[model samples]
Target: MSSLKPILLVEDNPRDLELTLAALEKCQLANDVIVARDGEEALSLLTHRDPGSGEFTLVPAVVLLDLKLPKVDGLEVLERMKGDPETRHVPIVMLTASREESDLVRSYQHGVNAFVVKPVNFRDFFQAIRDLGVFWAILNEPPVTTRRPPASTYAKGV
Candidate 1:
């Protein structure tokens, strides 16, 4: 399926980022992938509003976040996003190499939608990312919101 929304990838490691991107590309998912090298950059992108439209620019179908990052950790980013009304509905997946139990617990506590442990082997990593891409970008169904007319407008029309 063709996805209009982009996928947000917040990764700090260059090699991992390269590998992840390559894996996603191999999957041939139609959605565009936006990369942020740091937590600050990710937050900036997530919160940035367009001057003309007054709407946020970084609405993604899914967010693949690394646990460890510079300037602000992934947990902090996840917390901020979950706390914000506008961003709370966006699905966030913690994609990290860390296997600490505390990190997993903390991520779920902070309201991460999914958690994926990065595989050490190149082939395993590639397969894992491809599966993630296919599932999130293709199979997952997100909540749909419908716009309603204001009371004043409805009364006037009536």
Candidate 2:
């Protein structure tokens, strides 16, 4: 289930981010949770290169992305990621406060692995995030990918 892989959390709201972090911590998952306050930062982290090895560093097993975001929206991020073979296999879960059916439909159409509506109740939201952490990070089996292929790989029709 790629337990060693990290979990990427892309959230713009500070309160939600804190709650999610706390919930994940309660889960006691061995996987590290990388936080990005916005979609742009999330994408940057995903494609960040290591200074030592010159390789991408944020190849996570699962990405918990928020629907509405600053700079690039969640749907745009989802589309870009899904369009790329390198990141296409990474499971993306839409964790948002939006209850719009259109948003859910759009998310699924864009290939989001799961969509979770954030609960208004603090306890409910905490438990939901904890459950997600346990399932996605511990129980769910993910594809094995050391690192995604470079952009050039796509250019040659790979």
Candidate 3:
């Protein structure tokens, strides 16, 4: 099996999801692209500790998160992931169609690695996703995380 880590894509819109997937495919990235239709699903894929107890655990190479989502919002998801030691080191890029400045500010405040406004035109959006896929998946080298201690340990500053 390939050691390449998968990419978590959290998008609720069907068309947008399809387009993003296609763009990533065009990028020809070897890493798998996992889909999470909502914030809840994204959180489950990222967090879900205790493998023996049957909790889901997936630390993706990166997370492309949308701002507006069903159930839980992206900012909350970012906050939770950044707040947790298990997933904080994982990079997250906010990919959204929202032009609101507040959204951008809040995303940065929540520790998002990058914030990208989804382009309106088809070709632009496609190229944007392709560039993002190539950069984050193929070009960017992530930090090696060999140790995964319990969250409680970090709470005690150990």
Which candidate order results from sorting by TM-score in descending order? 1, 3, 2
TM-score of each: 0.89, 0.87, 0.88
> For candidate 1, what is the lDDT?
0.84
**lDDT of each candidate versus the true structure:** 0.84, 0.84, 0.84
lDDT of 1 at 8: 88
User: Which digits, one per residue and each the tens of the lDDT, describe model 3 over residues 1-158?
Assistant: 23567788999999999999999988888777889999998897677666564433466778999999999999999999999887899999999999999999999998999999999999999999999998898889988896443322111000
* Cα shift from native, residue 138, model 3 (Å): 1.1
> What is residue 147's positional error in candidate 1, in angstroms?
9.7
Clashing pairs in 2: none
Which tens-of-lDDT digit does each residue in 30-133 have in candidate 2? Answer: 77777888889888877767677677766776899999999999999999999988789999999999999999999999999999999999999999999999
Question: Cα RMSDs of all predictions?
Answer: 8.6, 6.8, 7.0
Angstrom error at residue 6, model 2? 1.1
Give the lowest summed-lDDT range of ten residues in model 3: 149-158
Q: Of the candidates numbered 1 and 3, which has the greater TM-score value?
A: 1
